[model samples]
Target: MMRSRLTNAPARLFSTAVVSAPKPAATRPSSDKGGGGGSGRDTLGRRLLSLTYAKRSAVITINKWKEEGHTVRKYELNRIVKELRKFKRYKHALEICEWMKVQEDIVLQQGDYAVHLDLISKVRGMSSAEKFFEDLPDKNKNRHACTSLLHTYVQNNESSKAEALMQKMSECGFLINTLPYNTMLSFYISNGQLDKVPQLIQDLKMNTSPDIFTYNLILTACLPQRDVETAEKTLLEIQKAEIEPDWVTYSTLTSLYIKNSLPEKAAATVKEMEKRIARKNRPAYSSLIGLHAKLGNLDEISRIWEKMKSSFVKMSDTEYACMISSLLKHEKSEEAMNLYEEWKSVSTSGNPRIPNLFLADYIKRDQMEEAENFYNKMVESDIKPCYTTWEILTWGYLKQKKSDKVLECFKKALGSVKKWIPEGRITKEVFRNLEEEGDIEAAEQLLVTIGKAGHLSTEIYNSLLRTYASANKMPLIIAERMEKDKIEMNDETKKLIELTSKMCVSEVPTCIS
Candidate 1:
């Protein structure tokens, strides 16, 4: 249960003011200005839409209206402020907030003050929020501004201020709802002053109906209390409160059992957890599966797997991946492979980790044929292989002495990753594989694939240059290609180039010599 710092807004803002019927000078919709008495609503909307991050953007547009004897309506200014916050341009959001305070036409509401305090708390710190709150005209202190102050105290760990303000709120009857109470509960939880929790919760139960979160906090406090007995008492107390125990309560209990090495109790808690929530809870299910795996209850793991697949819950790649890992743990590789195939057939997106898990198991068994078949199947299914997937294949094929297949897997893996973030140092693995065989054709094919994908990096290109140099082939063309790609020459490039020159004269691989 989270609390918002802003007060609830009115049903509408800037209602049309009354006027004598003879003149018919009345407000209208924002779209139709209806000739003059300038409000600058149009300019506010236009400036926000421009989406410029420049300092003068919002201020300059509003100031022009101010210079010409026009001011933006309160509602229009609020809309721009909200839009800037939504775009995550907090500086502009505060700028719009500040600009609204000066406009004669914009009469700031409590909600406006609420917005300002929250923004100040967000962009600046709680110190600024306290100062702003202090400076507020006493009329602005509503439930929102007051709670925000309590939150500010909570944020900065001003325990004394928070308790005082919380006392003030309780006396003023601002604690009518559970939100403020939950905030205080969270504060106690974060600060680890849980001895104060039971008393606070007892008071909460007497004055206000404690929700599930309040009970969950009590449950969380059990582990630190160093006894499962506390959790059980808390659960009974929760049921006594007529509050239904949710998955969180059960999950916490299950975690408690796991923490104390109580597998049977943990399993019972997971079963109860499964019974409570009607829909698919992936995290809970995965946790149960993992706990069972850790206990070596293969039969239980299998039953849970079947239960998960039959349920209405859509399985994620992680769920499938975890299942694959569990099966591997239990030496059920064939079953894991079949499950991977079935999962891949209906899956909408590909996850590299799943296949990599399968590939590792295959390589460990020296089942190169199966690994090759698996790789081809993944490619045919359009599930792209990442570096780990390709690396294992490279190692497998090199072990089988098929240098071409090693480079083939390397190109496919490198070509698959289209994201702009540089891939990690798997290029070293590829260089080692190619370097051993000294196969120029494989290196040439890899360089061609790299160029087409436009994934050039110093390590990747240098790996190839080193391969050429070790094999006594001049890599002048690779240097030229690096220049064309605008990749700057690093020390590795220079060292490889100089080594290649020496190799051209000596005509032997360095490792051989």
Candidate 2:
């Protein structure tokens, strides 16, 4: 949810109604349609998730349910959209944003408009995003909207545009908060443009007091250079400003200590992280578990896991994924396997990420057999793997020079996925191997899968076509298909066609016929 700037905040459009008691024997009507113990809100969440799965239009589906007498509060819609975004279901999320735009039942707030802008930016493009901002009424074009657009530019690393936008925001008197500054500073840190950050910090201090996020960005700037001195200086500045470091601050410091090879400092920072972890702060505990794993503090990792299991808190998908990843990182494969089994037992729907952590770790370690074994088990149990999983296996097989297994995984991948961005270097290496061998059959098989998935481009198609033409057969068929797909052949593709023609001529019999 977006936050509102002060004074320009949206007006409350509705009021609660006072009611008199109906009768002594009467009970208040339950909002739940089933009149069961479950909260209507909980049911609404499940219903929304189902709607997403069924590929229904979120706005239409939800409005239909509302018309049928189901309760769909505005706040619940916010929560559902947030959750859907977290699940990477952007299609449904954008629909809800569209719904909020047209729904005239309530007054639209600055935060609402910000959410709308961000979603539209993601689904559409920069032009649409600018149009959305331009279309907003004057009152809505204050700090939140300005910052929302600023965030879009900074996120994409359009540095000149972001800076230009920030300058415009200041000129319009809409730079009323430290948030946009913090965002730009964070962007600078991300791009390793730390030198430009000092001026921004100075401006932030002069105009408004910097928040914890600003200090955290300063801390992040020290990470790439392993500048512990500068990191300590930032911490001192934070303390001087009477701002106590929160979890993010401490987490950044912990990373700083880890990177700087100061184990004791990192250990102390983990203690600080633990203090912030209330019993139900599963992510906090998860972070601590991962930190200890990094530090090789296996005992602490086990202690935290034991605490989580003993506590009354319900473990989330994030917690399980974190703990599993931590265990694998620390070489506790046997223990990780046992924990994974427990997770599977509790999670009926299964978690793909849990297995992926192990898959990725095994791949990194070059333990191809183990990675394959784990992947097979996941498939056997009906837990669907994502594209990255298949890409990793394909990459591993390519490294081992197992062309057949590489082709096998590529086939399996097409069944489960539509499009995925593979590691460019590894994919190219595989292309090179298949091309040199003139394995036209294997090359065609892969080309067809990714082609239908619509991942083919001029560069990718050229490489594959060159390989097919190397075998001196069916080059025209592939070329014709590429043309049908509306892929414009580049100069490189033209050269490959010419080379194949010469090869075909050289192979022709000299005898008259």
Clashes of each: 0, 0
lDDT (tens digit, per residue) of candidate 2 on 1-513: 122232333312100111111221112222333212255454655655555352577776777777889876677777777766666666677887787677777566788888778877877876677778877776777678778888877666677667766665655556667899889888888777889888888767766788888888888888888988988888898899999788778887898899889999998987887887776465677788888888998899889888988885467778888888888877788988898898888887666878888888887889998888988999898998876667678878887878889987776666665456555675677778788877766666666666767677787777776776767754545467778888888899888777776654332212211
Please provide, for model 1 over 26-109, each residue's C-alpha lDDT reduced to its tens digit, 9 standing for 90 to 100. 111333122222455555566554545445566776777668887556666777676666656666667788888877766787
What are the clashing pairs of model 2? none
Runs in model 1 deviating more than 4 A are 1-283, 309-321, 337-360, 374-395, 398-401, 417-422, 472-474, 477-482, 505-513
- Number of the top lDDT candidate: 2
Residue 143's lDDT within candidate 2 is 72
The predictions' CA RMSDs to the true structure, in order, are: 15.2, 10.5
